[model samples]
Target: MQAVEPGGVSPYRFLLVAARLGSVRRRSQDVDMIKAQRVEAADSALIDPAGSEWRSAPSTRLSLEPTPLISQPSAYVQAKWETIDYGAIGNVSVQALHNDGGIFFRLQWNDATENDDIRDTDQFTDAAAVLFPVKEDAPLTSMGSPDEPVNAWYWRPDMETPFSVTSEGTSTTIRTIDPNLRGNGAHTGGAWAVVIGRALQSAGDGYVQLTAGEEGKVAFAVWQGGNDERAGLKAVTLEWQPLELEA
Candidate 1:
């Protein structure tokens, strides 16, 4: 074996460097490929915060692409594939409006199938979620770290109401369902529109409080029941988009 020079790089270090570079390249590509979308102040605020009033509101549409989940699989998820092909949902339209002390969001997406039944492990139901960082600088991927938690609002057609979930690093815990966290969904003409809303303040620990005119970040995810998307096998946004509340 050849003698090594002082301060010379090791093979392990070289591999780590290559991995980091690859990640940066992928991120840059995503930024270019993904078209970031934003919500504007509605002409008229939602008449019913959790209702279909958003249909009349102007929409901000965003293009969504399938996530390449390359990280090590968690115990709850057995699949180790880098990408899942669910005939990917292409885009989603979002609308937002705020009132006396809360904010509401409406998300619409097109799906060829309507999967509302969840009867077995193999059977999955259509679902969607909106994520916000507890801390302003929290990581957007892998939920979030313990120090930088993420508040997730999940909705399913079968559920009467939406529920909140918190994620710290790789761990996730379901929070109590709040009546104040209201949601209404409708599926029509091969599409689904969901309206969800919550108070401007945190209901408890592990929640993100929203305020009017304050800047925040958000991300979205969708699970196609017909395609067998469950757990970490769903399509997701590659990065967080800016969420600016109306004053």
Candidate 2:
């Protein structure tokens, strides 16, 4: 198939040509474009869906990270990083649900050692975060730029509740803790299970607004204290995952 020059042929002819010969170069470029344009998807935390309930919702594993990444605290390169043995947490199982005017999430993970106590700078605490875009087309990585911000729901066992933050690039500011946002966690049998809940909309400025039947994107990150995986040194999804609310 011969690649059609833009403006020289119609899309119909472009498809017909692509089907007939499908030039290797053109086909390869098309595939690349598709990947670049397509954002990966995941099941949104359900809203009052019936099943085993929030605690028993189906689990989805998230295990992807940035290439050539560095740990924020240690400044270790991706290949040489020893904490979590270079993304050793493997994957975290997650489930989400909403009820009584709020959305809830259950994140579970297995760790041989639990680092819940964070009393010193040398020691780090186990933590996780979920980031949602303030706007439909907000960038998942970089926590969105200034013009495009993101709302982050962060949880740690040491805290009585999760923290709501708005971020642009590397700059983040603590925002009002929405009365509707709160979460708790427990560690048992070398594993951790945490539940976080928040309203379906942004509480105020620089927050994402969630609604039933709406679609958006979310990103996940996890830090292992035992491995000194503090700051930027953590496991994270490489790209945005689909988030769609059920009516």
Candidate 3:
């Protein structure tokens, strides 16, 4: 498989500004937690974002904001993007489910342009990711410190499957292929629906292991390819949203 550099803005670098701003904090108690409903064994059909099974799952709408231009890792990167507006995809709808096999997330967002292919340097493929902290106190805004790593399930339309990304602080992202990581995406009617999933338990080292009846934290990021949003220059959730998995 061809290895693609984490693009749009360097993916993990987007959080550097948050670290500098000292916004890192433990998960909050008052934030509304999104529950991952339990379901029977999921089939391939359930992996489709538009599948009927999703109708039965609870949904949450997450508002997104542009990663600050001040967060770009380098002056050149900052300069190149200073004149343009990115992160135009302001919000996304999320639904989640877990079975005996794994946990899955369905994300849908409005995008007038379907940018699935990149044929030139100026082109980019739309992308999205779901992030979870490996440790309870890990900061979602900084993508975790070396002592508190973060796990990410990342998807881009051009890839045959999603990528498993782990990071120990900003600019420390590592990407690897995980056989169990699955993704399906479809674009229609001025919108895109995508599903990304993984086994309920950790696939291996560097992966977050999850359990039922437990509470955790999650975050999200989206790159609007049509707007040249990539890497650290995308829309993101600044805070870690609470997540609960039903027993």
Candidate 4:
């Protein structure tokens, strides 16, 4: 299959490609919006992916596809991945909950291999991220434009904590260690469950401030270390999904 160049196709062309390749397991129309359940302030399990509190929140399964090869940072990456099949992870289960303190997202996916060790040059840890647009009209495929940015709460099994990432278009990502961002992950059986949490409001610039009783947009990305997936070589939601928070 020929890889579609970024500028040659629409932002949502990945869906068509996946459909033609028979890789898309489900359509986005099945789950139109992600409703964040309202929880009490004292619920300590909000940040815990394995906690029982997640049982009360609803889950939305999203079908994912490989990011466009042309969107990669360099020619080396494009050439290296031209004939290779990467981003095989096809689906991810997502749940959201919020309280007066913060908003939490739980992402669950299946993986036969648990890659937590990153000691060698070829080794990389499994990772996931939840992205929100800084502006209402920000583009999802290119990770937003110069005037419009996107904020990402990134988590990996090897790190002690998650990272606050901001991006303006492809290859323009900036990662920061934010004390406010917290994450917990656990691998049980053949699947990985991860929870990333942050305050509803922003602590500083480059942070996407989420408000209650309003609607926003969110996207997801996953990197399978065993598949040598990193940077733009990961599975992602092609379009932004609507997110509605309870009042």
Candidate 5:
């Protein structure tokens, strides 16, 4: 165990705290002092069970070392994975490289579960979505009808999928779609996407809100929760295409 830093107040200075959270007793319970005193802004970091690789965080001096903080041989294998609960809003995207070598991008949306004022039940009830492109600062339009809840519109993208689903009840993949089908978070606020085919984050791998003022060269197809009752992608192929800018 490392010596604890005194009176830690800054969120970024939190590397001073260390906890071997992997340890838990099946027979008895123990209080983890490390998690109790964490100064990091997000609790998800210390507890992400799905983190297969060690990652260095830029905000703090801490390096999320290979788990099994204790020398016990079985410790690493015992940690429980945390489930990710994310809400969806219909997403718009852009995906082509400009002739000048700069990438173009765009997007807009509203989440059904995010806010009381903005939460629209059209999705969970009927599997619907909406789109607001950056061009007009567009208003929310239905993904389908409120009763049926689905429609198809092309948002351009710097389309690339790092992996493919290779299982039943799951047909998920990507294909290059259009150009000038631009959209992004510049109008909203904090956002993250694959810009110009690169994973971007306003703050490291985070998708907070979108800002229209901020544009990028990548676009993503955000699948709504209701689309997969099986808890995974369950379709043939997610359609994508090259959308040339309109003349």
Candidate 6:
């Protein structure tokens, strides 16, 4: 019955795993080092990991991340602020995409109107005749190309934002329209839906996992008619923090 070595553990030691682990690996020189490590780790014998000890760490000792600053528009979010404002084309209008080629959307900040009495409005209206060819550089109002045809597509302001896009066979998913429409009914079908998304997702140009968001992109492009596709947006801006929702 006496299987244990005289210098080793006794049968009673089986009750504890530490005892079963054999003597703690201890070197005479390491003894103080181990004790110090244990002191730093446990802080106190009464505050072991398994034990519930609410030892408060010093503010200086604790890892404290700096308050982040979001000044620029993010990929996942777009915010904008404007004191002076005027659309390149008079009256609220929609840009009609009449071709299959790509397109660009743009925005410009006109400081000239900064002194003018600017009326901030959530609802902007456009006439039946859309403000065709919105993309422009420099002064921006010059327009891209006039010859491009106008096609009818679906659009809703402050609609649902698209988090993901995929295709199955010949039919392209194109782009999704927002379900919830915001103020001002002008740009509807045959237009592009606008939603809040990250203005600048610096993570990289890869498919971000679809998740809920608060703010979304101003609008999106969709091809309602054949050849008419959601072209690229040129210069939109973000000045204020945007309320958005994610997919």
Question: Which candidate's TM-score is highest?
Answer: 4
Q: What lDDT does each candidate get?
A: 0.66, 0.60, 0.81, 0.83, 0.22, 0.20
For all the candidates, what are their Cα RMSDs to the real structure? 9.8, 11.9, 6.6, 5.3, 21.7, 29.8
- Per-residue lDDT for 80-135 in model 6, tens only? 31221112221111111101111111111111111111133432222111111111
lDDT of 2 at 242: 68
> Across residues 146-200, which tens digit of lDDT does each residue of candidate 2 receive?
8888788888778877788788755354656766677777777888777776777
- Where does candidate 3 have its weakest 10-residue lDDT segment? 1-10
lDDT of 6 at 32: 16
Candidate 5 CA-lDDT value:
0.22
| Per-model TM against the reference | 0.75, 0.71, 0.86, 0.88, 0.21, 0.16
Taking all chains together, the TM-score of candidate 5 against the true structure is 0.21
The full ranking of all candidates by TM-score, starting with the best, is 4, 3, 1, 2, 5, 6
Judged by lDDT against the true structure, how good is candidate 6?
0.20
Candidate with top lDDT is 4
List, residue by residue over 1-247, the lDDT tens digit for candidate 3. 1011234333234355445757564443313477998888565866888788898888888767677677677799889977777777777888889885788989999988899989898999999999999987887666788999999999999999899999988778899898889999999999999999888886667898889888898988888998777888788776788899999
For model 4, residues 1-247, the per-residue Cα lDDT tens digits are: 2223335343246457655866343434533588888888444678888788898789999876778777788999999998986676777999999995688999999988999879899888889999999998888788988999999999999999898999999888899988778999998999999999988886867899998888999999988888888888888888788899999
Off by over 4 Å in 4: 1-31, 41-43
What lDDT is reached at residue 224 by model 2?
76
Against the true structure, candidate 6 reaches a TM-score of: 0.16
lDDT score for residue 165 of model 6: 26
RMSD after Cα superposition, model 5: 21.7
Model 4 lDDT, residue 125, Cα: 83
